[model samples]
Target: MYFLSKELYFPPVDEASFEGVLAIGGDLSIDRLLLAYRNGIFPWFDEDDPILWWSPPERMVVVPSIYKVSKSMRNLLNQNKFSVTFNQNFREVILGCQQIERPGQNGTWLSDDFVASYTKLHEMGIAKSVEVWQNDELVGGLYGIDLGHIFCGESMFSKVPNASKIAFVTLIKYLKEHNYKLLDCQVHNDHLEKLGAIEISRETFMKVLKSEEINFSSSIQQHGR
Candidate 1:
């Protein structure tokens, strides 16, 4: 693996190890984060480890036009039981993601420093959160990097049944309406697969990023318009 520095660069994704670890030790500066996303690389390390960068051999992605919502999910949507909003309470959303436990994981990767850095990105309008509220309580949410056309999802959490799913489904509808090119889930899981996210070759993912299909005007509409 490669080591990073203050210079703000990561080696090509093609040079990554067989396990897809590309580099290590890079600070999560805004510039580095932008550069990393542009190159199809992202940071994913345990709180105890130095920042590790990766470009997976196969990328997990969701296309808004093709995303699937189950019959039960559709029924839930029709019930209008939850309210969804964007950027309404970003800090709370991310905090939920950091604290909510998941199976097969010992601890959260969202350390305090990671939260601070990502909150900065949110302030700069490059990161986004989807909040799901029920009876005036924040029940579920998700947050991610918005590289214009592609939203690189970081994490999501649900405190109630289908709360996180509600938040995600809302986001998917918005993206589909607004013509977002892709939702970059970064990695795959059975949960995402159930929602119609699929694995594509890294080369395909990189090509989509290079297309720059999302831009400022496209993003502004997402800000409560």
Candidate 2:
């Protein structure tokens, strides 16, 4: 374990020692947050707790071209009853996600500080959101940091059944259209696995991250255009 300081570069993170926890304690300042995303690390901790950075041993990810859409989902897509949009209402989406109660979890980890930090990232054009709407009401959505061709998803929520799934599918479709290679799910979950997310060794994930060519600022500008 290493203690983070303003001057120290994040130590060499080992896949085998993921449970060892590389570093702890740091402000989610723009510089540190940017560095963390570039190196496949992210903050996840309770509100009263110090910032805990983690890079799990097995990275869960979905390649846009290969995501699985079930028969029911296909029908939903055909109906087109719900609409999807990008960066439409980021604040609403984040608040919705934060309010959702996860099974077995007593409270949300999406603290006020977390919201403010990510909102700042969104302003910088690095964090993007996908919103799912039915008629005119925002129902479900997801948000993440856009690292060139990779989207490191943070969290998602659904107020109605299949709403989150709709947002996720729409996100993949948009990524496919725009040439994104990978959607980093970050951790494993049975629900995500059903949508074709798979666990790969952290080393493999890091290799992909290193080799992928990305121009973040240009991508943001293009999206704005």
Candidate 3:
């Protein structure tokens, strides 16, 4: 296990252990987080534990063009019972994610520091959120980092059945319209698998992440520093 210092640097992703832990103890500064995502790494640690960075052997990602929308979900979309919006109430959306319970997890990793850091990212327009509204009430939503050509999804929540699904599909539509190339789900879960997220080797993931064909400079400029 590698330990991180105040310096804004990360070990090569190939250095990660079989379990995908690459490094530990780095501060969650905006610059560090940006660099981490650019290099196919992310932080995931409990509240009392030192920050842990990971570059998993297998990454779960969604290609926007192939995102699955079930027939029932399609009907729900057609019904228009829920309204979806982007970058609206990001704090609320993240808070919702923080509070929602998940199976097998005793608690959430969205600690206060994590929230503050990502909120700053949102202020800079690098982090974004999808809000689902029903009768003007906030119901379901998701939030993540937007790296121009790709979206690094962090978390989501739904107060009603399939509400988060609705938010996710809506995000896919928006990504498709904007020509976004990928949605980084980080790891696998039944929920994401049903939505077309697939596992790919870390090498394959890094190839896309470091590809010369993808340019993040424009995205940074568009979103502002």
Candidate 4:
């Protein structure tokens, strides 16, 4: 594996392993994280392990009309029981994502360093979050890096059934309304597949990410803040 230094760089995307690991180590500075996202790479590692960057051969992504919504979700949306907000309580959202248990995982990948780094990004307006609230309490939410044209989803959690789904549906609607191009899901999973996230070649994804300028200001505006 290619190891990184403080130089804020990465190996060529093609150099990534079959498993999609591109590099082994790097500090999660704002510069490095920004560069990594621009180049279609992202960090994923456990608390005790070194930072591992990845740019898989196949990427999971969704956009405006591409996501699938079940009839049950449509009914829930019509009910409007859950309220959605953006960039509100970002720290809490990330913490919730980390604490929510995954079926096959023993622990969270959102370590202290990762949380701290992403929090900084949120402060700098480079990251964004969507929260789901029911009866005036935070129930579920999702967070991601907002690259303007594409939103690179990191993690999400739901305390109630389909709370995360509600957050996701709301996000997709807002993105569609604002003409956002992609929602970078990172990897393929049954959950995402059911939501209509599909696999595309990494090369194709890179082209989409680099093709247009990211409208960060517009994304912020989409929140009506």
TM-scores of the candidates are 0.91, 0.89, 0.91, 0.91
Pairwise lDDT winner, candidates 2 and 3: 3
Give the alpha-carbon lDDT of every model. Answer: 0.86, 0.82, 0.87, 0.86
- Tens digit per residue, CA lDDT, model 1, 69-116: 889899999999999999989999999999998989898999998899
Model 2 clash pairs? none
Evaluate residue 211 in candidate 2 and report its C-alpha lDDT on the 0 to 100 scale: 71
Report the CA-based lDDT of candidate 4 relative to the real structure: 0.86
TM-score of 3: 0.91
Residue pairs clashing, model 4: none
For model 3, how does the per-residue alpha-carbon lDDT over 1-225 read when each residue is reduced to its tens digit?
A: 899998899999999999999999989999999999999999999988999999999888776765566788799899989989889899999999998898888888899889999999999999999999999999999999998988999999999887899888888888888887788999888888877667766876787776545333443244331
Per-prediction tally of clashes? 1, 0, 0, 0
Model 1 alpha-carbon miss at residue 142, Å: 0.2
List the candidate 4 regions with Cα displacement exceeding 4 Å: 212-225
Segments in model 3 whose C-alpha atoms lie over 4 Å from true places: 212-225
Off by over 4 Å in 1: 212-225
The C-alpha local distance difference test score for the whole of candidate 1 amounts to: 0.86
